[model samples]
Target: MFTGIVEATGEVTALDLRGGDVRLRIRANSLDLSKIQLGDSIATNGVCLTVASLLEDGYESDVSSETLSVTSVSSWHIGTKVNLERALTIDTRLGGHLVLGHVDGIGEVVHLNPDARSWCLRICAPNELAKYIAQKGSITVDGTSLTVNKVEGAEFELNIVPHTLEHTGIGSYQAGSLVNLEVDVIARYVERLLLGDSAANT
Candidate 1:
């Protein structure tokens, strides 16, 4: 599990797709890898990948075929900047909402404009996933947790502050960019519990 808080930005040093699978190598800039061991999980661009090997400055992980089909990881190229976050520990702070590092669906940036002191980004979520998103709700975009500023059908808006822009890869986003998106975990469960009836009807 993760808190969806990006610790650092990592660069894709290598991406090799071979024989029905993929090998991803990332150079985690300013990210501490000293305590990271093989088999530890790392959240890269909202995808939870296991650390297959330890590198001098980063690590390597294998992206299975399933992950490729469901996520935007397949489109990642060398030099791509990705949000990086370590797995949550028992003692870690819940600075952001609980995130499983599981990409429910991919979204496309439809609009990006500057707000007063921040950027307003509007993304089109997949039809199936859009119903789960709500205004003022939490969503993880490319591994960075953020609040939804507004929601209109399949499109949701976000206010990206300078700090968020600088700390994560969101700063590099533009119109038509594909991003890994994970909806709030709590919302999913709530919907399941109230699948057939409203909360008041319960």
Candidate 2:
């Protein structure tokens, strides 16, 4: 599990295609790598990837065919900047909401405009995932947790502060950019529980 707090920004150094899967190599810019080990989980752009191999300054993981089909990873290219966050430990502070590093769906940037010092970003989410989002609720976009400023049907708005713009890849977003999105974990559980015994079939 993760807290959706980006520790650093990493760059995709290489992408090796192997049969149906692709091996992803990322170079950490500021994320500490000393504590990481083989099999450790790292949230990369909202996708939980196992550290298949450790590198001198980064790591490599295999992106399964299924993952590529469901995420923006298929569009990732060399030099792509990704949000990086190590898996949270018990002592870690929960500055953001609980995130599973599971991309529930992909969203598209519909609009981006400056709001004084901050930037207002509007994204159009998949219709199926719309019910999971709410105004003022937490949403993880490319692994960075952000609050929803407003919700209109399948589209939601967010206020991105200058700090976020400088630290994460969100600042580079433009219209039509695809992003990995993970809704709040708690909301998914609550919805399942509300389904009562009927949830078992699902």
Candidate 3:
């Protein structure tokens, strides 16, 4: 599990699609290597990936073909910046929400407005996912936890502060760019329960 709090921004160094999985390599900083070991879980762009190998300044992981077919991690190109966060520990605080690091779907940036101090980003998501995203609710974009400023039809808005723009990759996003999106897990459970009841009649 993860809190969705981004610890560092890592750039893609290698991306090789193996037989049934993709080998991903990224270089990072601000995360201690000594504290990490093989088989450790790391959140990369909102996806929980186990560390297959460790290095002095980077690590590598393999994403199964199933994950690649359903998630946006497979669409990333080399040199792309990705949000990185270590798995939540028992002693760690829930700075954000309880994120499973499981991406539900992919969204696209529809608009980006740079303001005096912050930025207003609007992203378009699927109807099924948009229903769970409410105003003031928490959403994880490429592993960086953010609050929904406004919930509009299929497109929601975000107020990105300067700190976030500098710390994560939200600042480099352009119109029509694809991003990994994860909705709140609690909302998903609620939807599932309600849907199950509605389906009982048929």
Candidate 4:
């Protein structure tokens, strides 16, 4: 599990396509990898990927075809900047909401405007995932946890402060940009519970 708090920003160094899957490497920037062992999980741009191999300055992970089909990873190229966060430990602080690093769907940035020292970002979520989002609720975007400022049907707005923008890849986002989105895990559980017996059938 993760807290959706980005520790550092990393860069995609290389990508090797293997038939239907991919083997990619990322430079860890300032994130500490000394304690990271092979098979440890890292949240790379909201996707929980297992460490296939450790590199001198980064690590490599294999991306399954299903992951690429459901995520924006298919658009990644060399030099792509990504949000990075190591798995949370039992002693780690819950600074953000609990995140599984399992992206539900890809969202598209529809609007981005400056709001004082911060920025207001509007993204359109997939119709199926819209029910999970609520105004003032938490949502993970590109691996960074943010509060929903507003919600309109399948669209929602977020306020990104300068600190978050500077520290994460959100600073580079623009209209039409694709982003990974993970709705609050609690919401999903609550929904399932509300469904009662019908939930099992589905």
Separately for all candidates shown, the number of backbone clashes (residues 3 or more apart, or on different chains) is 0, 0, 0, 0
In the range 112-191, model 4's lDDT, one tens digit per residue, is: 89999999999999999999999999999999999999999999999999999999999899999999999999999999
Candidate 1 TM-score, true structure as reference: 0.95
Ranking by lDDT: 4, 2, 1, 3
Model 2 lDDT per residue over 83-151, tens place: 999999999999999999989999999999999999999999999999999999999999999999999
Q: Report the backbone clash tally of model 3.
A: 0
TM-score of every prediction relative to native = 0.95, 0.98, 0.93, 0.98
Per-residue lDDT of 159 in model 1: 98
lDDT agreement with native, every candidate: 0.94, 0.96, 0.87, 0.97
* Model 3: pairs clashing at backbone N, Cα or C within 3 Å: none
Q: How does model 2 score by TM-score? A: 0.98
Off by over 4 Å in 4: none
- Candidate 1: deviation at residue 32, Å? 0.6
Worst 10 residues of 3 by lDDT: 193-202
Tens digits of lDDT, candidate 1, 96-135: 9999998999999998899998999999999999888999
lDDT of 3 by residue, 1-202 (tens): 9987888888889998788789999887776567888999989888899999997788999999888876787788899888889998899999989889888888999999987799999999977787889999999988888999998798999999998899888888999888888999899888678787676774
Query: lDDT, candidate 1, residue 66?
Result: 96
In angstroms, the error of model 4 at 185 is 0.7
Cα lDDT for residue 148, candidate 1:
97
